[model samples]
Target: MRTNTGRLSTRRLWALSAAVLAGVGGAFASVTTGETKATTRADHFLQARAAPTTAMPPTATASVTTESPATTAGRPVVSPVLPFNAKLTSSDIPVRGGGVRSGACSGSLIAPEWIITAGHCFHDINGAWVGGKPRYHMTVTVGKLKDGDPGGHTAQVVDVRQSPVNDLAVAKLSTAIDDVVPLTLPDKAPEVGQRLRFAGWGSTSATVVAPSDHLKRGEFSVAKIAPTTLEALPVVPRTVENSPCADDSGSPYFVSGDNRTGNLVAIENSGPPCPQPGREIIARVDILTDWIRTQTGDTAR
Candidate 1:
């Protein structure tokens, strides 16, 4: 598995190497390679800095990389958490083949139509994988905090399913969604240092590309937890920046301690250029919780 293409400056972040790691935002975004054709536009981007690769082992690959759209470098939560605040937000289904929706990528809400994100944000733009059973649609906004904020609650995916190993996926919305509430997965996982808790809407700037509708959060710890994948690292030190950026790719890494606490484990995948600091990776939802309960059969509480 080897495919590499680069552009991502004006907002064309696309980089998939070995097995996983698509850029743009939720799978990142932005695409317009050769033929001199360029019209990709989607604000919430992410992607840059993948880290794992021993020649690609771990079943085959599944290193989890794809980031480059939306927004997420942290900073905004003045008082978030209100209506169904399990945190959710995603966008990238503009379809045209390659992708380019710019911003939106941050989810959590285990079962209620399943949420989970980051299968390269459902591919597109040449990377393929657009979300089974679909006519090109990916929207998951719920109780939003900014970006138009009217009470939140959008949903319209249908199906996605991706995680034979890691960068994980779940989609399947278009129905449930009323009061949020779903996050609670971690039966075992997350240790290295513990102290997680990261939400997202993305874009706080680690280089520029801005895209934050609000719904932000910070706090990092778990330095490394391999098994499927995990990174964290950022208790606030790297010159005061925090971590997780570039549309925060499928964001949702929580487990505040106190005995399970918020639970959830990890989701976002790809980091390092955000707000300056580093280490973010994230993907191990407690070993995928029985592969997300056989793909959203929901039971692994």
Candidate 2:
């Protein structure tokens, strides 16, 4: 299937239909009944690029650029760009043998040249993640607190490497981003009830599905810990006010309160539309810590 930004291909349509049947496109399902069901929308690239009808406000201030460093979770916080926005220009993929086109999703910067995101973000038109070359091109923007913030970096994704054990992937940028601090990997998986904070550029609400122009964060608690996934329930602003929405896949979940220096326990994997109150499913990064370090050639111990 050709992946150029033209009309959607039949195979792409079929893959999306298959995801809906497989319960993967829950990002588009609705539960406004005011009744919380165990809903988790693991969107596999279902993009409806609406205008920024409701972009969530930035959670952190221009702290990255402050004259004096502040602290959170007991560590000095440098607002350098760690999390980022990955903008895609491909068809909405349900699974990248050519899916996961998701027009945009949050990404975690672990190395100056490497970024880890949900594996679903890259694939062929057939929904297969045949790593190395991506069917479509992608651009990454970081360092900026919000769109138009001049203090950041931008790069084109030149290559990609997908995970075999989890819903994760690491993309190689055209150039190194040595100025910003990268988020640290975890030494162990998170425990149930552990508190975490996450930020993203995904939609603010289900109804406002456009990816945000800035990063918005909220608090959540680890409800269940699995080998490859962590189920978390939002708590900070309550469920409906803030949480992952469409195009939020691959955003980071900081174990320490200080996101800048904290250990990334998880990455936004899938969730029902924004503020679902139901647990939002995130992919475990602990499972791929070594894999990530190896990918970036960062062997420091």
Candidate 3:
């Protein structure tokens, strides 16, 4: 599969996107050829739009493209500040043989010690999926209202595993996060036209290129569903401003429930520039429920 990269005014969102898309707000965070974090909390469901009628083939590439170091695109954190947000990034995500990569990313806690994110977040210099250790120093921060907020749990990422079928990946944290409840994985697939919610860390819009520390949560409707991916359009505001931006990779898309908890179904991958443009191409997680269970110790119902 071949992936193409896009450029922005200031920051480049995501990494190596074949132009498809979901997650917390990522797998969208564009690494400045550089780096990329954020979360998803669904508290409300707003109005939605009809699904796109066009038939789209599955793209092998998952997110936008990772370009540099601290300038990655895509936003992750999206909220007033709560748990469940797994902000992802590495000082240098090592590629096998040689070279290193760094960037911002977002994810959702699936278990006491596990977080799920975009597989492309751990790719090699050549864009091939990488496994085993991630981040020369991988750190996951939860519940940070602002970028520099210290009021959250930070854990060490020990192991990284990529899916063979889709753009999903799981990380094993050194310590278990006992405070926040992990997002749920539903067995049912998301229907087209369904309105789902998301919260990711990102710049407010394409024009607002600087990464924000605050979580940006909003609602969107599913446009189309594929075997392993889906497309969504911004629905809450139903404008380009409400759409997911370029940086956050692995931000979650979920069905919101009571008390901020939600169902994990898909993650942010890639698409056009934020605040406007094409539908988002996201990786579907529902298809891999069983495998994620096995990898993360079967999250209790």
Counted clashes in each candidate structure: 38, 19, 80
Ranking by lDDT: 3, 2, 1
Q: Which stretches of candidate 3 lie above 4 Å from their native place?
A: 1-82, 93-101, 205-210, 237-241, 299-301
- Assess each prediction's global lDDT (C-alpha) against the native: 0.54, 0.59, 0.59
- Tens digits of per-residue lDDT, candidate 3, 33-113, equal 232211111100000012222332233222222222121143333333347877765444433454433355678888888
The Cα error of candidate 3 at residue 130, in Å, is 1.0
The digit string of per-residue lDDT tens for model 1 on 1-301 reads 0001222545232222323322223332222223222112122332322322223223221121222223234321212352333333333333233433333456766767777877666665444545575434445665556755544555567788776555667778766753445677777766889887777666565445444656677788887665566766778764212345655577777764442226678877665444555566667877668767877785544
Query: Which regions of candidate 1 are displaced past 4 Å?
Result: 1-7, 12-115, 119-121, 132-159, 162-168, 171-196, 199-242, 245-248, 259-273, 276-295, 299-301
Q: Write the per-residue lDDT of candidate 2 for residues 135-158, one digit (tens) a residue.
A: 555667666556755445556677
Ranking by TM-score: 2, 3, 1
What value of lDDT does candidate 2 attain over all alpha carbons?
0.59
Error of 1 at 270 (Å): 9.9
lDDT at 159 for candidate 2? 82
Tell me the deviation in Å of residue 81 in model 1.
Answer: 24
Q: Pick the candidate with the highest TM-score.
A: 2
